[model samples]
Target: MLGTVEERVQSCPECGEEIRTDHRFVPWCAACDWNVDPGEPEEPGGRLEALRRRLAREHGERLLAEVTTDEALRPRRDAASVLALALASAVHGFTVALFVGGVLLVVLGWGGALPVLGALCLPIAWLLRPRFSRLPEDEQVLYRSDAPELFALIDEIGGAVGTTGVHAVAVNGETNASVSTYGLRRRRLLTIGLGLWEMLTAGQRIALLGHELGHYAGGDTRHGLVIGNALGSLRTWLYLLSRIESPTAPEAVLNAFYLLPRGAVLGAAMALDHLTLRATQRGEYLADSFAARCGSTEAAVGLMDALMVSGSADVTLLRESNALRGHRGAAGEAESGLWDRLAAHTESIPASEYERQRRRGALRGHSVDSTHPPTHLRRSRLLAVAALPAAVTVDAARGSAVRTELSGARKLVARRILNGG
Candidate 1:
């Protein structure tokens, strides 16, 4: 998902105002007291199951066909490639034009009526430029020499995928693994979730790493950076415009004139972004296929199942955070027991029932802004790939050593989380 569940916003059809409702099924607008169909409240599990069945009936056949057809599965870079270059050029050109135009207007002393207006606007654009700066590394723990095992695994996965190794690796508290770029250089950073590592088997772990590494091999991260920065610039520009304080009527009128064109430009950027969403989704499928090649189909499937099973990590963390209140130093110790608690909870649920829930969860689909395809769609695509030879198994000793290394990393992560870093 693009954001937290609580962060999901809905627009009221009647008022066209954003509404923050407690329940998704019952979207009630706080502004106009607008209610959407006011149907009987359905249990979360029942809703998920219904969604799963509905999606299967609607999109299952088409998804299966797309996955099975080799041509359909191929990643088409022509559109995304062109769009990325065009977007980068447009943003750079616009900024440069703003600065140059401002300088010329000031130097020529043209239009006393609009004296230095361009010069004044230039500073605003430059000030807002920081907001479009390259994404920073958000992980609390930066695992370089500290996590040699992970670096080695990343290198191995990079070799398997025929790409240069990652620049750095880090761990987070989430239940997902992702590859991202930082700064203008677009240096790669691979982030793995401690919770996900605790849940997956050795083969599944390999598959997960392979999936992330596949993004680099497929150029998804590079293209994504272009789109991401463009969107970021648009958002920052919008935010700066919105925050412009119009203390007087004249200032309000002036701000409105300034914002009007920028707003149109923002709208155009959004439309361009929408056009590339399909390419982003296809990149995900390509990555899945790459993972299937690196690891066996079984390993890829296992990784997907593990993802479904452990998707509740957010909820678990929330509960743990509450429980950790007033127990400051003991947070790391509390965290150490989380995996065991989760394992026990999983065991308490019957295997058949767990599978059913997992299948249902997969059908709920991802949020609109998510770049990855829905879990159900990805799972289907993996199933369509022809079976490959078994992946090489890690030796028991090596496996044990990797787990030991991960365990150490987990403690560090736990400490970081507890200390509120």
Candidate 2:
């Protein structure tokens, strides 16, 4: 009896075909017609199908709530931010003083000290800076109370698109989303805000997610991370030092004394930042195309419209909220002024709609919960993508029960992953 039981466990349940335990970690029981780790609890009406439906519903709600609520998606590292600032500040102060003093010394007959001081600061800057720290894991950075379904979606799309599974999905209350890679192994992170979830249509959401995944799959995120970190350090150092030194110094004197080496750093940093930002924007366009090929166009359009509406709505909400709270910031006021000036220059939207959008856009400063290009711009880009002929199309006639089952199962897992399971 013991020998028979062991044999049964190893055999395929359906055809009695030997259940090949492939070393690649794929546990497919051909006889039983099942995967080894069929993720999620099975439900009736075909367990995987039912799970997919549940996930879709949950994903919709999460999108809505994430945008409307005030929740911290990632842990705030005051210490890290402070350390970064201090690193820049310290380097700037020392460099400025050295350059100025060196020039003054050269004029005062003490030139040899300049080279010694310059040599010393270079090593100190390298030593004092932080080492590569892995960003907090996906689970730690995000909170997903209703994550099962989003995980399901990610699995479905990522599998079809040949991208790594999403490592994290998070929402801050803003009309934006971003994907990033950090550290040695370059783990991928998928970040969405409450604003984005609530604002985009389901199809649009998928498209956006696809775009983020494209970055992960294409290795753009990792490149961006390295460039961003390197440029950020140099930018900070240069900006701080430039501010500390007086501008009245002659251009030749300034470059020779304070600017020559630092200017090179500044230029390089600017180029990196610009390139990184441009790459992200371009990734959005490709993802738009990717999602269109894989899924429903209606869903894609819905996502874009949702984003636009929500963004317009949030601006109005913010202005009112700020007034109610009786808080006014200089930068916020300046931003509002800029918007007002732009609004004046543009063709007028309807009064009611205009007021509504203004209120939503007014919610705090750009730094608060804002990132990404404005909704109108993104919407225009999506529409352009939609106009393109799709590279691949799903064949309804060829779709099999097995394929449906696979899609359903994948969806469930992706949703769970996204929701932070």
Q: How big is the positional error of residue 351 in model 2, measured in Å on the Cα after superposition?
A: 12
Residue-wise C-alpha lDDT for candidate 1, range 294-332, written one tens digit per residue = 677788887777676664555555566667778777775
Per-residue lDDT tens digits for candidate 2, residues 329-359, read: 4334433333232233222223333333323
lDDT (C-alpha) at residue 24 in model 2: 19
Question: What do the candidate models score in CA lDDT, each in turn?
Answer: 0.63, 0.44
Among the numbered candidates, top lDDT falls to 1
Every model: Cα RMSD to truth: 10.2, 25.2
TM-score to native of every candidate shown: 0.73, 0.46
User: How much is the lDDT of residue 145 in candidate 2?
Assistant: 32
User: For each predicted model, how many residue pairs clash, with residues at least 3 apart or on different chains?
Assistant: 0, 46
Off by over 4 Å in 2: 1-124, 127-146, 182-184, 221-223, 245-256, 270-280, 316-381, 384-421
lDDT of 1: 0.63
Residue 175 in model 2: lDDT:
57
Candidate 1 residue 75 Cα shift, in angstroms, is 4.1
